[model samples]
Target: MNKLWGFIVAYFLRWFPHGLEPGLRRIGNPGPESPVLVSGNFSLTLKRLIRSLVGQDLWLLVANSRGINVWCAAVGGMFTHHNVIAAIKTSGLADQVRHREVILPQLCAAGMDVKAIREEAGFQVRFGPVRAEDLPAYLAQGKKKTDAMSRFRFDLRHRLDMLLSNNTMFYLIVAIPLAIFWPHRLLAFTLLFWAAAFYLYLLFPYLPGKTGWSRSLYSALAVVLAIPAADFFRAGQPFLHYGWMIAVVLVFSTVGFDAAGILAAMPSDAEAFLHRLGIKRLGSLLQEKTLGRVALDREKCRGDMICYSICPVGVFGELDPDKKITLPWQNACFACGACVKQCPHDALSLQPRP
Candidate 1:
């Protein structure tokens, strides 16, 4: 029953921080030579990691990322070099581990300063595979990550998971009041919202837009159009009520706007477009300036292809194997800093558009 409840409330749990007890945890029976893995203190993330390492002998260092998962926490700036260093020191890891190396989730690379952590914490940080499930293989393979393991995927199952995480709370909040006051309208809107969300998630790749904002606007417009068309079937009655249309439009637009974060991959241009729209609605103005773009230092680039594989968008292209790489679609760069951090040779940097 406890497991069932945890599964049911998983979506609600993602919104806030959980499992904030930051310290060192001994997983299984570990000697001083056992591997030490570090991760965020998000309860679910910790739980998942624990389950994955059920039989493995190791030490787990839980860092306070304000209860956020490693990826999101790092991107939001909550997970940083300070958090990792604090965890290392406060947990007294030095006394327990014989080696001076710690493994962090690869996704955390974007937010964490690896060099700073090593310099301050006195431990070399190695990034593990992107998924916790692959930890055993990664460890067994001498801590080497393959291109497939490093790549981030947004397949159908992942999209469904994202849809639930993003929309479950909104549905519950809106459904309760309507269910209490107007059960009929509650059912109608519930179905509407569910359908709209499914459309957004399932058809996201095919959505006719370059940016998240544009795709969301297009999807919202479809929902708005469907309402009037459905009403039209009721002949001899008003096909479209102005007030109802306005309410539907507002709800759809509000939900769609969330695509800025919920969408599997968002480009930098889309983020800028959403920011402009958000600021303008408050009766303010934004003087547009060219934002920074990712720049490659050819001399420093080892042509390791890590950047090409890890980039969410296909920003970097290979000109020659292990020799040359070119930025064909530099404009699509989201500046997530994943490539910059993962690059072994310090070949990549973000430079402001001049």
Candidate 2:
């Protein structure tokens, strides 16, 4: 019951930070020679790491990331060299480990400064695979990551997972108040909400483009078609059909806007809209971070290859092939600003596109 309840909270209220104490934990019979790994204090992330790397003899260092998962925390500037430094120094990890190196999650490459962590914490940072499940293979191969391990995935399972886990809370919140006041339309609202969200999610990959316009257009199209379909099924109930049409539109308005925050690598339309309205983000994913362009100065490119290794998307290509940084898959840039943050040579810059 407790584990099930934990999953319910982790899945539903994940929008809020669920922090664990920042400290060191031993997995199995970890010794001084065992590998030391690091992650944020987000409870779910740690649980997954423990579950994935179970039976491994290692030390896990939990850093203070304001309870955010590694990718989000690192990109948002909460998880960094500073947090790792604190975790290492305060956790007394040095005495417990024989080596001077620690493995961080690869997704944190967006903000974690490898050099800084090395200099300050006296620990070399080797970024691990993108997913926790890949950790065993990563460790098995002497911590060498393959191309498959570096690139993040956005398949149907991940897309639907985000739909079910992240945004379901928003729907519940919206529905409850309406359920209290307009109790008669509760069922209609529920049906419309799921229908709109589900249809969009099912066809998310086939959506026209990676822009807010495509989503908004498809959302309107879905609601528009839904009225006719509902009417066709109930030819005599014209009044009921119109009522549902209105309900569908109302529910879909929030759904499309809400989708701006989902798993697609596209920039958040909701954030951009809020930014235009003179509202600022609460120090999370800044709208400018996504709206701005990331430019690389080849002259400043010392061929350090941090950008090549750090990009969650396969935006940067392998350095060995060109002996220089390349953006072969540039359009796939999620604009998380990870490479820009960790660029030792200051070669990459992010600015609003003119």
lDDT of each: 0.73, 0.76
Clashes of 2: 1
| Candidate 1 ranges beyond 4 A from true positions | 1-9, 179-184, 226-238, 241-248, 268-274, 277-293, 299-324, 328-332, 341-347, 351-354
The estimated TM-scores of all candidates read 0.82, 0.89
Top candidate on TM-score is: 2
Q: Write the per-residue lDDT of candidate 2 for residues 212-254, one digit (tens) a residue.
A: 5466566666667866777768785435566565666666666
- Candidate 1 collision pairs: none
The number of the candidate with the highest lDDT is: 2
Worst lDDT window (10 residues) for model 2?
A: 280-289
Cα RMSD, each candidate: 4.8, 2.9
Give the C-alpha miss distance for residue 16 in model 1, angstroms: 2.0
What is candidate 2's local distance difference test score?
Answer: 0.76
